[model samples]
Target: MAKKFEKIGENLEVKNIVIHQLLKDAGNRLVNPKAADNLLTIGEKEKTFLGNLDKSYHKKSSPIYGIFAEENPKFRDCLIDYINGDCQFYDFSINVMNHYKIVLENTVAATGGYMIICEYRNIITSNDLLLILMINNKEGFVIDEKSLTLDNIKNLDLSKVDVACLINLTEWVNIENNLPSERKTYLSFVKGMKEVSYYFMSFIDVDNKNTSTESTKRLITAIEAYADIEQWDRNTKINKKNKVFTYCHDCIDNKKEILLSTISSILNPDNPEHFQDFATEEAYRVSEIISGDKVRMKFLKTITYSDKEFKIEFDTKLILDNTIVLDGSGNKLTIKNISPILRDKIKELSNKNA
Candidate 1:
């Protein structure tokens, strides 16, 4: 990420040096030798000029340095919208702008007296604001006192131009912290500004300088966390490309007769005579479609009697269908004349159901 901004700092440094040299040369040509020597000292003139500008515009506040081309309409519009509360942050552009190229060349020409320097100001802070507009080529001639024209300003070949906002990170953090958390609009604005700042910082060439403070480190951590959550959400969406479906079927109707027979035996343990009555009532409650013939046959098959007197077994089917059974003396008698096994097969079904 830092590679993206690798050339920006270098470009700015080279331009600053060239502008300073031009100022020195201009002093040499416009003043006496001794006076030029004092005024053109290595860093004296640049320092003096900056000091005077700071005093005039930011008397009691830290200075903010913003570097940009004067003619880039997108950049200008973004700045205006942000200042006017119409946008959250100054939207930086990646496409190379022709105006930025013009400014780059004119900064050098302005120092050489071939172009005039122009300054524009707006209140970025209560006590601090510095805005400079660099004009070059024929446009600069309109305001040049010396009438120096440099067509060479148009010949400077530059492939890319970068813009940056220099701010006191500590002061920015303090202001952000003091804002009420309930002010969502303001908070969102601050977050957008931080995102822009972090992107610029990725390539701003800090040059091994220990510029990180506790506050800046915390802010960076927050931005990284937000990035991670966004990545996770994106991955989750990609992973949900496949879908599945399930269905269930109930087959309780198939086992309805068996369930009814077992429940009847369980309810009438002491009186086997009432087993058929219990089954009929339960079957009607469970399913209205159970036929009378099917119910009677199922009841008969479920009940049987063992005669201890004659050691003979008489099935309920034979008794109910024929209405007769053999007694202990081998005499034919009514089905009700026979004795039933006190503990019958129904008890076994009852225990199994339990």
Candidate 2:
């Protein structure tokens, strides 16, 4: 499992910010990034866009644990140059915008949006972070600062964030200092629309570090830990656990990766991100997207308790149906209703003995 860090956009002190427009002409397959002369002043609109950016990032991101790919290190190179003062923030933003355009060009049927690039430091941890948000041009309008008129620019609807990435510069720098087991990936990103977001991941240049099994294991552990802290009764715990298991099984059957945010919502709909926050704070480090492991996750459907004298196994569904009951205080278990097959089997054995 990977070590978790503070979410990217929390407690931000915006040091620099820039926005570039990416638009598509009718009938053109690719979009282009418009030229920008200066950084935007950190104002109310920007603050409003940024206020919940971190929360959205937390809810939407998938972790990438490895460093930049050696063969194509354009993003890493640009980032290093900017960090080393070889390039200004404006120039870096332009470079990223250009790269995104290149990626979009190669991607068939790829579209474009407003790209907001920001460099900020966490007020609490003082960690330097970079955030890139891509908002579709049609959803909202960006106000023109000069004339206070709506123009070609667009302000992101934080609620509708589709594609974005948050890079932890401090984590990247100190990645080598941490032990192998302690190293968490520096990049967290989300591909908003399933079909349209692959290029966005490629634009960021990161490799996934954890395997499906590891991610599944950590997720299960996180859920169990959270339930323990909540002090849920056996039936409630089993019911919720079964719900998670069913969702995961369905995803696995469809060969899809499980979404942490979805699981969080399943655990607590009123507080959608509560389980996610617990996983992070408790250092379970569950990625927002993880592949389900069929072999390891199979146990979640049914629970087993065994001893030298006998073995007991039952489906978690039975607990919720009131067919099975657990007495935690007395360390006793009761089965209210036995299946007809089991009852007949017991009756046959009794007649044979008699």
Which candidate leads in TM-score? Answer: 2
Best by lDDT: 2
How many angstroms is residue 108 displaced in model 1 relative to the true structure, after the best TM-score fit? 12
lDDT of 2 at 223: 81
State candidate 2's TM-score.
0.55
RMSD of each: 36.9, 13.2
Put down candidate 2 lDDT per residue, 179-223, tens digits, no spaces. Answer: 332224576655454222556667877664454566677887798
Residue-level lDDT of model 1, residues 232-282, one tens digit each, is 353332221111000000112121112223332333346533433432342
Show pairs that collide, candidate 2.
none
Each prediction's TM-score versus the true structure = 0.17, 0.55
